[model samples]
Target: MSAQQRRGEPPPLPEPLSPLIDAHTHLDACGARDADDVRVLLDRAGAAGVQAVVTIADDLDAARWAADAATWDPRVYAAVALHPTRADALTDDARAELERLAAGPRVVAVGETGMDLYWPGRLDGCAEPSAQRESFAWHIDLAKRTGKPLMIHNRDADAEVLDVLRAEGAPETVIFHCFSSGPEMARTCVDAGWVLSLSGTVSFKNARDLREAATLIPPGQLLVETDAPFLTPHPYRGAPNEPYCLPYTVRALADVVDRPAELLAEQSSDTARRVYGL
Candidate 1:
């Protein structure tokens, strides 16, 4: 019995009955923002059938917290890397620290790193494309050296992203975290054997392209994520998103792929565990 449900509480609904894994999230960021809010979030998520989550921290501060959080719970894992939008804070010292943290046992991957041209203006330290490229390369190299999967966060700069990744040949288990792209791009990534992780955005009525992307991914390569505290699914789109709300997104993904949610949950969860080597 879980805390959310009492013995007589309608038998707890069975939680959609699937082994689902949220491949990308920011538990520490959301948790620290509200003073241990993540624990309640994770508890709710567990009740909803999410077996595990990989929380990513894009900066040093977030990295420290994520590492510590993972230490506190086996269901939580961490990924340390500088996000594209935060590329301005890049320093040799920061890189060194990230590298050190990446070596930690809980650090399962090396990213949330990539290009983000969607911002109105360049992020403070990442104003130049060259510097962003250099930083991306460094992270890629780190992934290779560490033998960890590389998680990516792509924005408007798809072409350059493809170019850089192709040049670098990407790590073996490359993933497009929070994948929000069109059909053609999804096809490209799928053909490249990259994993495409869908988030709450897929549940949007207007996200036709992303829904199309869901159709292209096979069970072995598909994944689901919350990217929590942001991108809450429909019906709860405006509320604070946590892992508990992930089922809504998963249900939406099932609709896109024309499969039942239970099977989709099993497939996506298995795929995610394989990718993260869990």
Candidate 2:
């Protein structure tokens, strides 16, 4: 059995100290495959004090599903993009369809897109880094054209990703989703007026760099996410993650920044709304 199964179902966290938003997640990946699945998951989140969540899609089929999923539930919004590793899928035909889905109602951001060097030599059959870089630039342009926030997914390619953003001149709103860099990177992003969206990984006991980065972002530039079905927070590190698991990360971030949990939630939610225009 998986660790999560051996441990049994994950339990609910205490109700959030204030309203919060999950800046990124993938409802489809979380086993919320349809409206009913989405509702069941979202209801759990609502009861836990999460007011909204953005379901991000990393491929064309999932992008279509994500755009539709956003409309299926009132509290769920969407962000559509080709994940960097899947950059090879961004053919002319895919690009056309992505543009259409990006403009779909309730699609709030353009991302989970950026360079990810974690899988060199086609790990998991990923496209090469050159292809990933090409795709990242195209997505950046789409964000500008769509007038949506650009949500980036940087993995072991911080310098390269940031360089592309600088070279291409970023869209008006840029956010580094699931930020995994250090305090220096955090300061650099904030200096560039980009938002840093923290994920459950921040709660890991060994995440000292992440903790220090948390201290660098101003409240206005800070946001949080679950990156569900992955990066499940500590104390439940191996548990199945869903939107309801967000409070753990929020509480963790609140502690690291030495801010009141409620105030942090309030501000982070506000930042999410402004960044995504939700």
Candidate 3:
């Protein structure tokens, strides 16, 4: 879907099931600019059975925003880090600030960090592989020190990401956010005891491998997210996404894993809570 199409009207909320948590989202990107906006957005989500959301940071400014956003509501939590694409901006001062934010009580993970090889030469200002690797290692260390989960963002660099995690010594809890790899990678992550957080991508018609991978995840290691304002579930593929749209993805995932939607919803929320320490 085109960017314009994806930014169009928000999809209608799906039927409410057991309460679920949007393990990852971007409230700032979803037009939540203040405490009131945050409450409104989350209220809509609550109506659709989404009980909580973890807003993730992709840059220094966003990390600051996410940390404070968490204080705006009880249901909101935060994950702070520089995205791999923006690893070039992780200067000393930025790193110091991120260290502070990552230790915040409301900040639950050090994340949205890893390798994004898909954007290097193709996207302007994308970080080089070396810089991305260095930043990812730093974030992993922060997660370890803070006793929080490491939330990873891997795109077309699964092998490299896995290698870096192994070399650097991964945190006790590691989550592969928006996991899009095939079953082989999925199995690797599962075997390594890493959590795989699926997004609306799993609901796409062409995501056969992702659907198959979903079936491999044990309930304890599985989580769900909207990755909101992007990757809206199918039938609303090109529409604007928000936490309220999460049930659509959950129902879709249920079909993929051959589990009842309510059971999957509870399991995903429980796994999210345990991994994030919510």
- Give the top-scoring candidate (lDDT): 3
The total number of steric clashes, by the backbone 3 Å criterion, in model 1 comes to 1
lDDT of 3 by residue, 24-134 (tens): 999999999999999999999999999999999999988999999999999999999999999999999998999999889999999899999999999999999999999
Sort the candidates on TM-score, descending order: 3, 2, 1
Question: Worst 10-residue stretch by lDDT in candidate 1?
Answer: 4-13
> After best superposition, candidate 1 residue 61: deviation in angstroms?
0.5
Instruction: For candidate 2, write residues 95-175 as lDDT tens digits.
Output: 999999999869999987999898877487797889998999999999999999999999999899988988899999999
What is the Cα-based TM-score of model 2? 0.96
lDDT of 1 by residue, 1-278 (tens): 34323332221223454577889988865654432565666676788888888989888898877877777777888899888777767798998999899999889999888888776364445546676777788899999999999999888888989999989878888899988998999999989898999999999989998888779987888889989867877756666667766788888888888899989888888888888888
Q: What does the lDDT read for residue 61 in candidate 2?
A: 89
Q: How many clashes does each candidate structure show, in the order listed?
A: 1, 0, 0
Once model 2 is optimally superposed onto the true structure by TM-score, how far is the C-alpha of residue 188 displaced, in angstroms?
A: 0.6
lDDT values for all models: 0.81, 0.90, 0.94
Candidate 3 accuracy as TM-score? 0.97
The residue pairs in collision within model 3 are: none
